[model samples]
Target chain A: MSDPADPEAAPLSATHPDQPRDFVAPGADRDFAGERLTVDPAGARALLDARLIAAHAAGDTARLVTLYAEAGDSSEAAGDAAAAAFYRTHAYVFALQSGDSRAEELHRWLLREGREE
Target chain B: MTVTDSDLAAVSAPVEQARGLPNACYTDPAHFAREADAVFFASWAGLAFAADAPEPGDVKPVRFLGQPLLLARDREGVLRVFLNVCRHRGMILVEEAARLPRAIRCPYHSWCYELDGRLRTTPHVGGPGTNRHAAIDRAQLGLVEVRSHVWMGVVWVNLDGKAPEFETYAADLRARWAAFDRPLAFAPDGAFELEVACNWKLAVENYCESYHLPWVHPGLNSYSRLEDHYNIEAPGTHSGQGTRAYRPMLAEDGRRFPVIAGLDAQWEEGAEYVALYPNVLLGVHKDHAFAILLCPQGPERTVERIAIGYFDTAVLGEDWAPMRARNAAMWKEVFEEDIFVVEGMQKGRHAGGFDGGRFSPVMDSPTHCFHAWVAERLRQPA
Candidate 1:
């Protein structure tokens, strides 16, 4: 099992072999890049995106799925069709890993030619 | 089973010859107060669903017979009814329907009570002792309990403190429909609450007869003929009619709920609609059952709280949103169709020339049975 805190950890396999080694790992330190950047909307978005990338690299599939779904919603809200489609694909992968048939069905419907923007 | 001479004399004068309970009985302020004491408060009136108070510490507040009543499932999982008012200062203890509070605290003075209606704490009252009296016993200051019984998922409370045992009163109904005693779940979409501008009895009367099915409910008449319906009357106890052509809701695979053991094929086609004495009306079909509690807001206004419970709770978790919407639409249509008749009867009762109208003997026996029951109750000395 991969350590969720280690960004360089191995990707999760199809079979859930055992519980994660660092299942009860200690909390990490919080660091701010800049005072002005902390409050800026664009900075907050980039920070969230970086966190998702870290979560995905650490093999946190549940968090990855939720982040992807949130990203898809934001992209659709901002009229970014290509970005929305990419995030939706990521969400579909995570949903499959999470064993959610309902989400998988919705993802299948969204991937159809007529549904794509 | 014998009618006394007084009982015979009371009912011997035909409904036409005898003056019906006056318009005041349906629409006056003082009369409403009197009926609250004589009828509504005296009898075991249906108040809430048993499922509403399913677990220990589950408490639901209801306004019944113009008084706030709290229905609670105690530590032993026994349902108990109590006046919602605090014993200390008469403040309402619980105002909401669903709460699992460790203690019911009065918002006014913080007098706390246990889930079982025992007074738990009267903070600072006895300690300071500057003005407190020794007669103030916390044990005796428990919330006033009202007599309550749960049958077929309905919670009935007798507010007068003394009434016949619920089992004795409802024994005939129990024997008549004994097979429907399985675990039932409320159908989220099939249940509704309706406010009608009519007396509560008027709603009961309208439900007792099937003569208006063709004219009022054309959709139902298309499926069930008038001849296929029959009145079920247990003399002075309860009255309802049953239909033989009930079609069950089909699953996506056309499967129906398994019928109870010992029930014949006739029960599959059978649907019993019963008005349990004063306020509750229940409709039991093979696949589903629904009940309505006709709560009297005033003489001319009644709130009909209706709920449709299913045979299986698991079915509700399966495609619930769509199935609920479908059932809601169907019930909304049928109940909407009943509004005109109930409201019209209320208006008709006010006419100077109108006597308590005649019964068709064959077609109107159900309604006559209901009228006779009401007349007997009214004639009894309170």
Candidate 2:
């Protein structure tokens, strides 16, 4: 199955059209203005997944809410509807688990947007 | 009771005429306890740097004013301050300084707390009639939170729970450094910590003026002249000295660290050493940054932790150990020269006749400002 959420599937820079772009790991130092830089998709995804898994294993709903929200944003930005939906569900569950009103509102917004589509 | 204008005027008068707070203020254990309540506990005190606990779940345990404090970043990446005691059986939660944990577990009872200070487990304390124990109100029992704020990478905590808002207390510093916010990074090479055998305030006083630089730090005085130094007095709150000559620790090719986005090349010629109210001292130069946190251990003892962080993380990848070593050497030379003066002042405070030694009305404004702040806080009703 071709995953649209693959980081390599998208151009490094959407805003900077003229810049020659490249991907660099988190700790690498490259000229930000001269080149388009995209974080390694697998590594970024792994970080998000690991944080969520750890939070879930630890029963840390607050952490899960934050990680799921970040993952959902990345997935949506990459145009991966399925992955985005999955992350949104986790965000909703973690939001309810945390009893955070702001997270609850975010969950509602995600659901409303999903229903509208 | 509020301190009157006359009271302030009296305290701010030339140190000689002012009749400094009794010798007890610096020596007596009873007075130190009072200060814990009046100053360290009541007002905002700088605790640790934000960089120490940058990521979510990062935690740093600190001891300040005889209280164990846990500085942690929550799962949401929000920095939170809590007493380092477990809710169950009152054991110290974290003993080391490092990144955040999956849970803060008590060593004695294995009771766990979430990074946000929520009680997550009581560990087999719930069975039969114990499931709803009246003695343990889980809802009301979370980590005791201390009001905390971050500015310029320094974390300031209000222990009394009644301090004025952080914005209000640090308004002066925020306004002063508002321009160079983006490019400012803690220079890992320039940062340092020291243990001074004197009251923390004495260290602040020594740093607030350049009167001793010529005689004490002759190496620094070679390029940074005493006359080129200026006093930064944020009346009754914070004070420090500024210097004009700030040389960057350059790489092998003479390349300097990346400057902040909008700063001019002349920033090196415009260095500022700001003492953030109680303890933190920051030296912001165009090429690098250095900060020190002076923690008071006792009336006669203090530990000053200094860190020289850089604006560019890329510098760490370079053969920059030499730069770190040189910067540390230079600061060590300068601070070592300060020991005598601080220790001298501590010992002088014990004299029966030395009623707050004289201050040079011209060059001592910064020290006067610090004295004024100490006097003001000391006079406030506890």
Docking class for model 1 is incorrect
- Candidate 1, residue B144: CA error in Å? 1.0
Q: Which ten residues in a row have the lowest lDDT in candidate 2 chain B?
A: B123-132
- Cα lDDT tens digits for candidate 1, A1-117: 123377564322211233232221112122232222223546546755886888868867566655665565556556665565566555544554344343444344353512321
- Over B76-103, each residue of candidate 2 has an lDDT whose tens digit, in order, gives 8999999999877788888887664356
The candidates' DockQ values read: 0.01, 0.02
Best by DockQ: 2
Clashes of 1: 0
